[model samples]
Target: MKVEIWSDVMCPFCYIGKHNFEKALENLPFKNEVEVEWKSFQLDPTLNPSETKTTVEYFKEKKGIPEAQASQMVSQVAQMGQMAEIDFNFEKALITNTFPAHRLIHLAKKHNLSSEVEEALFEAHFIDGENVGSIDLLVSIAEKLGIDKEEAQKVLNSDTFDQEVNQDIADAQNNGITGVPFFVLNGKYAVSGAQPVETFVNALQQTYNETVSPFKDLSDGGTSCDADGCSI
Candidate 1:
């Protein structure tokens, strides 16, 4: 089954959703057969990558909510992170444009290291409270993930992978998606937000059953050959 996840590293819920989604996969017998692709989506595309503010400030400014409300909401998200076993340091989290970070993810996808880089981005933004939009920071993150440092720096420094990142954002818009952590299972079922682990597990099974071929009940009559001998 192919699972495409539309997410933003700046969104704490997206990180939580990733954790729960991976946990759900662990409960499945066909876990290894499942393919997960992280698609990029920027919550605030217009924000400048070079300029960053605390996540709380960004939330208040965009949502037009009071500081108290925004702080309360942040607290609620912190609790959710606890449930997902992620230690989110929102106070330190810098909010900036995720476009550059998304580009790095696209670069990682080329080497089949997208998921690894995605997790590192999440940790950089939410846990370590670093500016994910920084070219130097992104290159260092890629280096840690076994991606060639020069290649990563080149990709991040130039316009490489920009189209792939833009295409992902365009896809989310074309699909009328207005939120982060939107999951598409088997190119059919859609799960939005950080839903419960059970919800993900059920969706995985439903999609897998619908798409995968079932085992044939050949033990009753059909003949087969194995290392030991051929059935007579």
Candidate 2:
């Protein structure tokens, strides 16, 4: 089974959802048969890379929420993160564009380090409060993943993977995806948001068991004849 996840690195729920999904996979009988592909999505694509503001301030400015309300919102999300054992420091988070980070993720995909890059980006932004839009920071993260720094830097410095990133966003739009942490299982089942671990497990098992047909029969018995006799 293949699972495609559309996520934005800066999205707090994406991190939480990833951990929940990981827990689900761990408990699944067919875990070894599952393939996970990370797709890019930008929550704020128009945000300037050079902008210097805390995430709370950005929310206040962009969403028209008061600073106190934004802080409360952040606190609520942080409490949710605690459920996933993720330490989210929203106050430290920097408001910046994620396009560069997404492009680096695309580059990392070719080298089979996309997952690592994604985790590192989430940690950098949410935990370490690093500027994800910085080419230097992205290159450093790639280097930590054992990717060639020069090659990674070259990709970041150029327009490489720009279309790949855009294509991922385009595909998300075509799929009617309106949020992050959206998961598609076997290209058939779509699970939106940071669903609970049990929910993901059920979805995985249900999709895996749907081999014979997409439509399921809930009736206990049908009017089928056996070799011995016909059933009522």
Candidate 3:
């Protein structure tokens, strides 16, 4: 079974979804056979690198919510993250343009270290509160993960993987995905949002069982509606 997840490192639910999916995989009988790929998905493609705003401020401006409400909402998210064993330092988190980070991930995919780099990026941005948009920070993280630092720096400085990152975004849009934490199994089954562990486990098990053929469409064409209207 192959699972391609379209998620952003800055997304809180994406982090939680990663944990849930990993837990599911840990209990799966065919864990060793499963191939997990972290596809790039940016939450803010238009954001400027010069922009300096906390996630709370960004949410307040984007959603037109009051500062107090935004702070409460962030606090709630922090609590939820704690429950999932993710330490989210929202206080120091800098709302960044993730295009560069996505490009680095594309480069990491070539080396089969995409998952490691993805987790490092998420930790840098959400937990460690590093400026992920910075080229230096990205290169530093890449170096720590055994990726060629100088080569990564060159790639980051240049627009090497920009097209691939943009293509992933375009493909996500074409597939009707408008949010993070979208899971695509075997290029067929797609479950959007941070679904429960049981949901992911069931999908993985079903996909594993139906591996007799190369192309298996596991998605049932079900409605994409959640409690808050149709999921984007």
Could you tell which candidate, 2 or 3, scores higher by TM-score? Answer: 2
Worst 10 residues of 2 by lDDT: 208-217
Where does model 2 exceed 4 Å of error? Answer: 211-232
What is candidate 2's lDDT per residue for 21-93, written digit by digit as tens?
A: 9999999888988888999999888888877579789889998999999999999999999999999998789
Q: Write the per-residue lDDT of candidate 3 for residues 55-111, one digit (tens) a residue.
A: 899999889999999999999988888877888899999997888898889989988
Order of candidate numbers by TM-score, starting with the best: 2, 1, 3
TM-score of each: 0.90, 0.91, 0.89
Q: Relative to the unseen true structure, what is the C-alpha lDDT of residue 19 in candidate 2, on a scale of 0 to 100?
A: 92
Per-residue lDDT tens digits of candidate 1, residues 1-232? 7999999989888999999999999989999999889899998888987799986798899999999999999999999899999988999999999988998999888899988998999999998988999999999999999999999888988998888888998999999999989999988899999998999999999899877755545476677899999988
- For each candidate in the order shown, give its overall lDDT on alpha carbons: 0.91, 0.91, 0.87
Selected candidate, larger TM-score, 1 vs 3: 1
RMSD of 2: 3.3
